[model samples]
Target chain A: MSLQASRNISRFWEWGRKIICVGRNYADHAKELKNAIPKEPVLFLKPPTAYVREGSPILVPLYTTNLHHEVELGVVIGKGGTAIPQSAAMEHVAGYALCLDMTARDIQDECKSKGLPWTMAKAFNTSCPISEFIPKERIPDPGKVNLWLKVNDQLRQSGCTSQMIFSVPYLISYISDFITLEEGDLILTGTPKGVSAVQQHDELQAGIEDIVTMRFTVDRQDH
Target chain B: MSLQASRNISRFWEWGRKIICVGRNYADHAKELKNAIPKEPVLFLKPPTAYVREGSPILVPLYTTNLHHEVELGVVIGKGGTAIPQSAAMEHVAGYALCLDMTARDIQDECKSKGLPWTMAKAFNTSCPISEFIPKERIPDPGKVNLWLKVNDQLRQSGCTSQMIFSVPYLISYISDFITLEEGDLILTGTPKGVSAVQQHDELQAGIEDIVTMRFTVDRQDH
Candidate 1:
């Protein structure tokens, strides 16, 4: 009813908005997992409680033995809309962020075998750790940017936006047709290859081209 | 940080918080679907975009032909906490609302078999419709209340909360253990048996004993 709130895009997480994720958007990543490259985008979600900034650590859910890190580019919505056209989708972008879509691989494997939802594997607390927002002006061409990830100082994931199966605008338009993207809502574009397990005290570093980089420590949650 | 923004519980939907969901909490329903009774609660999520009220209609996603209606009891969290104990879990409740977890059964079945998330099937626009909020005092025993649903004036689901395999407090405690429950967050505590498909012009009426009732019409989404 009212116009979108005048919240600062830099602090959108504090607004408690939706975190819609796209899975398997990279062909290499799909191959690495021995999965079929999807014809359409694979989608999932992480609740707001999943968000953790630099000050807080990425605590592994107590139930999982394998906690994997997925480096992704997160698009933050500046405008809200339903059935947004691809041509006009970029107009809705406020900016972007470097993010990790942490996954509990063991739990995810069990859930998959049992034909269950991936919530336990994907939506736990500290499942989503992100960098500070990067204004749209910082990246003149989102489609050509580079994204990289490192664990313990060794590069684990390295890819470019050009390798994405679906373009950012295409994803925005497709998702908005049904899910309704709103201001402050986040859409995590799927990860690149080189996803692997992380142990306690491990450090993860990720970046978006030469624009921004973020670091986080991994810790185990006590039962 | 700002004392929960002094948000009115009755208008929690406007706040755009998480809609965490429990699946197969009702044994009879799991039996009907040929799913095993889960040892622990099965969880999923619906984004805030899925919410719709009485005045609006539930539009079946163009991707699904078997849209099913699942009547559920929704718990509105008033306080925020993590790893909440079972005994003190109820103390965090702000109130309750009768809700519908509308699912695109066909798409959900496909997702389940492929080991994918249920976003398209479960989190589309208008997938969640809820009744007016009932203060905590109104429902003295959420575990013993009567919940029922009718389609086109024919009773399709009639089950008491007494049939739920997992009680309200246990669900709250279990969920808050990994996914922190926060102010204004709503949780759909799963549906009972008798889940079935609905079509265009189908009128859905559901209630929580005599405490609250809500209604909505269904129609196919035009592509």
Candidate 2:
């Protein structure tokens, strides 16, 4: 086999592609944050540098005191296109991963009130912690998976993908209508309700029910 | 020379690296928009998909009609680092480019009032139109250069880098403190005052003093 063909797709994160994120895609999440239901998908971005694998700890940025953990399902794109139709959105999927959208809540609140970008609150190093990639054949229905997270062995968040206000294909089409979805680009299908503060040295365990689970530790980042 | 060495720095955009942008970095710009002179640098990100080269027309997104043009200087990173000190920031520079931070003013206003992300307002396909890269040797003092933009032969924005609230090295240091500066990544120092809307087929001409000049036409995007 050629070098590329023999390689596993699990290492796709190393490609350094876009990490397009959906915000407030779940009605429960929107209600928890007191944000109104959106008429359309709200989007944001995190650079490739945000990705932290299983071994490394999610470092809470020194600038933020109240760090929050937002667990969500990550869809890895296999193909790339612009203005892609909703019907063909799934063909762009390569696989999936469980991801934590670590946020600095305090900073985000200030930015929100002041009408500022969430870069400091959301785009810091080790902000994204991801699980092992699950192939397409593993889960027949992505919309029905149960994503749960625990902090220090205490259940903190648990939600069904069916609770998403926008479906996977719809988000793909909506996002692609504006931002071009490229190969290896991972779309974070928004977080569920129950996003709360996570402290230093906190142990975080998250999983997509019946298929895969991953564990990570949180530590303070230093200068 | 190896395959890398032989390649010119101008091709850095093709590497698909992060495009970190500074906002309200110019005092005049802050005032023009009625925004406070920020105590520190305001930052944001534009994905690589936003880049549009010369000869390609900048497409106006169907979602907005009031597309404004803000011309700024682009810094291309040569070295990668985190928590980079301002003193050593200059050494990380590889070259520079003249770029337009095309924005949808109407959509941005709505996003701001709602305290939402600027992704839809700022990050769209062809949102960033850039000129060819200039090597580091060509511009020894980037802070002293002049940036001017003319729309359809009328001088709309005329300003100097000296008016920048945060200097180039300062921005590099600040941004790298949060977002790691990778080689091939870009940093768009904020634009000066005099930002306004442009209609379809309007010509945009921008340059850095007598160093480099680029022109592009605007066109409405179709579904």
Candidate 3:
């Protein structure tokens, strides 16, 4: 297979390893879903094939009926490190992107109940939709930006990063302690409240302040 | 970063995406662990950083008191496909490797009880130890091979591929229906009967019918 450049980052990087995601980072979001606030970050993963860029529609997997859109701020790692200190974590970030963590809620719930892995629910193709990246310099304070998402032109989620239970640097430090963070690896900071089911032909838009914006359409998988 | 050859596979392949795994694919193994026989294949994942070779030591994560070794066969994908049929699945096979799915049983049990993702329990660095790849032709009958692991000359896991609940082709087909498979990606067939903990300086030797053999030492994380 030929090497391909990342859709957003201009530095010509490939999807190095995995897309690590944090769950229940925002108090209100966790409360909305009736989940206890986690003492530490809850983590999951999406394979590289889950990546979907603009101009392509997010295909709802045939196995899931309830697919929800979770808007999040994605931290793209520029440098790789292990056991990185929190004070110096920011030095490893290359940029940021607006992302949607499309989830198969029904499948996920079933997996959780049976103590099974969440691969089918979170790691399907087109499960992640991202916007063009904004260099870290552009978003001087990643923890204080406002991010929102709209479904079919109606706002569904609106929140600020300040409400996150864990900060970007803290997550980087926490994750690198166990899983080595490599260049091109992405960290999907957890979503906020107002996550709802999306269906075929629905148009979704999301942005982070004015730094980056993205649009996507949902379609059912025919095969 | 420049592309590097896979640690075990000699065909100059890069770590494509995820390390997809099968759990409870052997009924005897499931019974040994007191887990019910799964109706379908149980899936999980390990990140690329989890890949470790013979000379390297498997570091015991500081958080777990019970770390067990699961010996299994690893299939390397040479072609990428989605929703592929079983008849065509074998064409995608590149080769096979003897692998160890190191598990933190204590942490995994906690995560399972809480209905949480197993990222912490399963995706840590050095969680997977692999032997050099044996080309597909060398193992023409993947379903009829003997795999064994010995810890300090005491036999732990002894099993044969004939006992697998899910044949490799069926697993590849079933997995592709939900998760896309890519070249250089690995599929860890589930382990069999015996599993026990290892400590610092423990020597591990595993092999597949004299076709390929590898040895590793265990060490505790100093930090």
Task: Give the whole-model CA lDDT for all candidates, comma-separated.
Answer: 0.91, 0.90, 0.89
Worst 10 residues of 3 chain B by lDDT: B4-13
The C-alpha RMSD of each candidate to the native structure, in angstroms, is: 1.6, 2.0, 2.5
**Model 1 C-alpha lDDT per residue in residues A1-223, reported as the tens digit of each score:** 2223445779888884799999999999999988899999999999988999997899998899999999999999999998999999999999998889999999998988888999999999999999999999998777888999999999999999889999999999999989999888999998889999999999999998779999999999987
Query: Which 10 consecutive residues of model 1 chain A have the lowest summed lDDT?
Result: A1-10
For every model in order, the fraction of real contacts preserved is 0.78, 0.64, 0.71
- C-alpha lDDT of candidate 1 relative to the true structure: 0.91
What docking grade applies to model 3? medium
Pairs with steric clashes in candidate 1? none
Of 2 and 3, the candidate ahead on TM-score is 2
Best candidate according to DockQ:
1
User: What would the TM-scores of all predictions be?
Assistant: 0.97, 0.97, 0.95
lDDT of 3 by residue, B1-223 (tens): 2243323345322455778999999999999888999989999888888888878899999999999999999999888899889899999998988999999999999998988999988899999999887799999988999999999999998999999999999999998987889888899999999999999999999999979989999999766
In model 3, state the lDDT of residue B120.
89
> Of the candidates numbered 1 and 2, which has the greater TM-score value?
1
Model 1 misplaced regions, further than 4 Å: A1-6, B1-3
lDDT of 2 by residue, A1-223 (tens): 3323433557777764688889999999999999999998888889999999999999988889899999999999888999899899999998999999999999998989999988898999998899999998887888999999999999999999999999999999998998888877888999989998988888999999989999999888887
| Index of the highest-TM-score prediction | 1
What local lDDT does model 1 show for residue B113? 93
How does model 2 fare in lDDT?
A: 0.90
